[model samples]
Target: MRFKSLKGIQDILPPETYIWQHLEHTSRKVFEKYGYKEIRLPIIESSDVFTRSIGETTDIVEKEMYTFPDKGNRSITLRPEGTAPFVRAFVQHHLYNEPSPQKYYYMGPMFRYERPQAYRYRQFYQIGTEALGTEDPKLDIEVISMLANILKKIGLKKFTTEITSIGCKECRPHYKTALKKALKNKLNDFCEDCNRRYEFNPLRLLDCKVPSCVKARTVAPAIIDFLCAQCTHHFETIKHNLELLNISYVVNPNLVRGLDYYTRTAFEVTSEALGSQKAVAAGGRYDRLVKDFGGPPTPGIGFAIGIERIIPLIKKSIVHDVYPDLFICSLGREASDRGFIMTEQLRNRGLWVEMNYDELSLRSQMRKADRIKAKNVIVLGEDELKKGKILIKDMQNKKETEVALETEEILKAVSNKK
Candidate 1:
């Protein structure tokens, strides 16, 4: 019998894992620059966190979430998205009590039950950030510009920023009424999902990607037009501030968050290289969520970058392959034992070192070292061990420097060369 990974799940192997690390490292630098701290949250939460925050009417709650009952009969779910869980944590921990706008960033896998395709998976990863307790329009612009900076730093040169305001509670009712009236006659032309969304969450109708639904929504009312005075000014300020940062964006009236909690200033950054899965990162404001979760009145905004979606579009020029700094090739049992100690010593000094345990010939071990592209190599055998000295071979220049066999000597040799 054989066991294999479940469907829609993948093992991120070498070279690829290097890219993931690179993306995370680069993202952390940019996030820290914007005064956002890292927050680690659990992968599972009470099902209500999402149902209430993301909306029971949306596809995620109705069709996609990995939900089930635990042994305690409590309904639990693997988080389908980041914001809901984040808000739940904020309220539960009283993070709101500490500051006006607590900023946090998180990176980890997110689970969903959707069918796997190109970049879509049942188990995927996201890099997300949330700014809680503030609704200043300037913060919105800064968040959007920060996303643009991350993409730019990651070498994603071609991406479009689509911004929109999904008017807050005061203005959404009027737009929902207008949108429904415009699409009512053509309900028959829309997909089944859109029809359901029309009655429950009409804003989602504009978000449908089905050909017929897309066509039917052409006449639907734009949410921006219905923005209340406050929301209108908020949206306008986002645009103007973005310009001040020299960031380009498009006001996409059709853009709307699938979640119910989002209020005002929604945006997405997309790349044409992704085809149908175009959005690499997206987020919006959710001002009422903290209060709804039993915390004090607070506002929040955030975005999640689908790591899988962005990985494919990352330019090859920026990603680098990881290789060992030193390969210790051992010939015999005694030499292998010595090489093992030396390898650990080098690694403890913050060097990437590799070695083969099998009693392969010197020629074979050297070949393996070359194949791994080690920066330097050291051969360990009876002859070198007896003399208490070894040759450090520089792989690139093929220069050999003889050094004492002691760990400190080898450490100094590599550290100096590096």
Candidate 2:
């Protein structure tokens, strides 16, 4: 029997990894500029952590979570999303006690049992940020601005920012009641998932992708209209700040995120390139999350971008041309041994160098170097080893020169351009 990788998983091989590296590098730079410190969390956590935070009625908790019984018979699950675990970490480590507003950024794989498609996968990666302990609308504006800048930096031209206000604890009940009344009679025409969501989270029905649900909810009540006094002001303030920064956005009535904790301001950076699954990044205010996770009544907001979805968009939009700095070519046994030492020395100087250790022929080594597109080739053969010298060949200009293996000579030879 031939074993194969399970469905909805992908292998990121060589050339494809260049895109991942670029994305990570750009994310770090942008996140750092916003004063977000990096935080790493465990991939697995208590099942209740997600059930309580992401909401038990959500698909992630209901049918998609990868849960199992560990050795102690404790329920553990691979994280399906990024925010809940970070919230757990924030409370467990007492980060909320020391700081008024703690900002953290993270990037890693999240697992969910779902159907795979072009960009959707069961196991995928996300880059996100969390800001804790601030109800100020400015923080919301900052997060949205930072996400927009990141998309611009990555060269996503066909994207737009959609913002909405999902009301706070004060006004959501009224909105929920109105929504249920509107859909109560038409529930039979909705999908089973939408029918279940109606009682648990009517707002989620707006996010349903089913064509029938979309048509049914087309005239459904929007949460923005029911915002309480405070929520309405906060939402208006977020919009004012965004306009102050000249950040363009469209107010989306149905942009309630998938999670239950979100309140007030919600936003998504969507791309036109990916058809129905066009949301490259989405997040919003989760003011009650910290308190729900056992921390103080702190306000927090964040956004998470799907790395898999963003990478393909970047590849289609950005141009990256990276090549090795030098290639070490070994001709014979003795030369191969010395070449290994020389390779280490070059690497120690903060240069990218490559060489085969299995003692392939000089022609084969040169071919490999060419394949990797190394700029310079350093040939070490029996003759050059006997003479205590090496041949430096510039791959671009096809120029060659012999230099002594002395420290100064080797450094100058490698550093000099052809």
Candidate 3:
């Protein structure tokens, strides 16, 4: 019998995984610097959480989520995104009790049953962050600044951000009414999806890509125009703060994010490397979500970057030249044991070390070290054991050095260069 992975799901193997690890590693570095601790949530959650929070009218809840019933007939679904589950945990743990504004980051796979495309899949990975309990527009600027730094750090050169203000609860109704009125006669001209959108979720009219729908969106009302004084001030202050931070952005009226929870501020970052489906990351403020989820009113904002999309755009060749600090080449029985011991000691000291073992001749052992591009190669043979010394060769310089069998002696020499 033959079996394969389900369609739209692909395995991440070596060379490719090298890039994934690099992105995750660098995310930790940048996120931690911005004071975001990592959070891990269950991959599955109660289905209503998403339907209620994401809005049943949104495509994610209405069409794309992977949901099924358990033996008890309770519906459980694989999370299609990180935010809702993150909030569920926040509410479950009552995180507000610990701090006023808590920031957390996460990296994991997300599931969606949408048609797969370049840099998108039914199952994909995402690196996301959530800053809870703060409504200051300054936090918006900080989050944007953090994303820019992360993008730069990962060597993503072909990307830009588009920012906008989506009217809040106090303001969105005006825009929605105006947008619907503007589309009254043109409702039939919209795509089939937007036809339903007009009746169910008129705000999503701007999200459609069908030519007629897109053209209709061109005439649609802008949320920014309807922002109430408070929302307007919040949006304006964030823009000013962004300018003060020297972060550039484009004002996109049609950039209302796909999520129903977003309010006041919305933004998307796109990459040229990934053609028309260009957004690599997107997020906005959702001040009403905490209360929507049964918690006291709390303001929050965050973003999620598609690993599949970002990896394709990153110039990973420049990320880092990974190599073992040392490679141990052992030829005899006694030498193998000692080499094994030396390997552990070097690793404990935070040095990446590789050793040649099994089915490898001395010549082949050397090749293995070169294959890994180890900086230094230690030759442990019978003669060297009797001599109470080992030979260390620097592959790059083709230089040789000798030291006593004591591990510290080798550590001293290696630590100096590293």
In lDDT terms, which candidate is top?
1
Model 2, span 1-418: residue lDDT tens? 5977789988888677878888888889998998899999999999999999998777788899999999999999999989999999998999988666789999999999998888899999999899988898889999999999988887777789999999988899999999999888899879998887787778888988799888988779888889998998999998998999999999999887777888888899888888777889999999899899888888999989998888777786555667777788887788788878878887787677788878787788899999989988888877887889777788989898888876457667777662
Give the Cα lDDT of each candidate.
0.90, 0.87, 0.88
Worst 10 residues of 3 by lDDT: 312-321
Candidate 3 structure quality by residue, lDDT tens digits, 13-67: 8778888888999989999888899999999999998999998877799899999
Where model 2 places Cα greater than 4 Å from the true spot, the runs are: 183-196, 209-215, 317-320, 330-333, 356-362, 382-390
Task: Enumerate clash totals for all models, in the order shown.
Answer: 0, 0, 0
What tens-digit string does per-residue lDDT give for candidate 1 at 1-418? 4998988989998778878988999999999998999999999999998998888877789899999999999999999999988988998898998767799999999999988898998999999999987788988998999999998888787999999999999999999999899988999999987787778788878878899888878898788889999999999988988888999999899887777888998999999998888889999998999999999999989999999998888747554766888999998889999899888988998999999978898898899999989989999889999999999999999999999999888888887887
Ranking by lDDT: 1, 3, 2
Candidate number with the higher lDDT (2 or 3) = 3
Better of 1 and 3 by TM-score: 1
What TM-score, computed on C-alpha atoms, does each candidate reach?
0.93, 0.91, 0.91
Clashing pairs in 2: none
Q: Which candidate is the best by TM-score?
A: 1
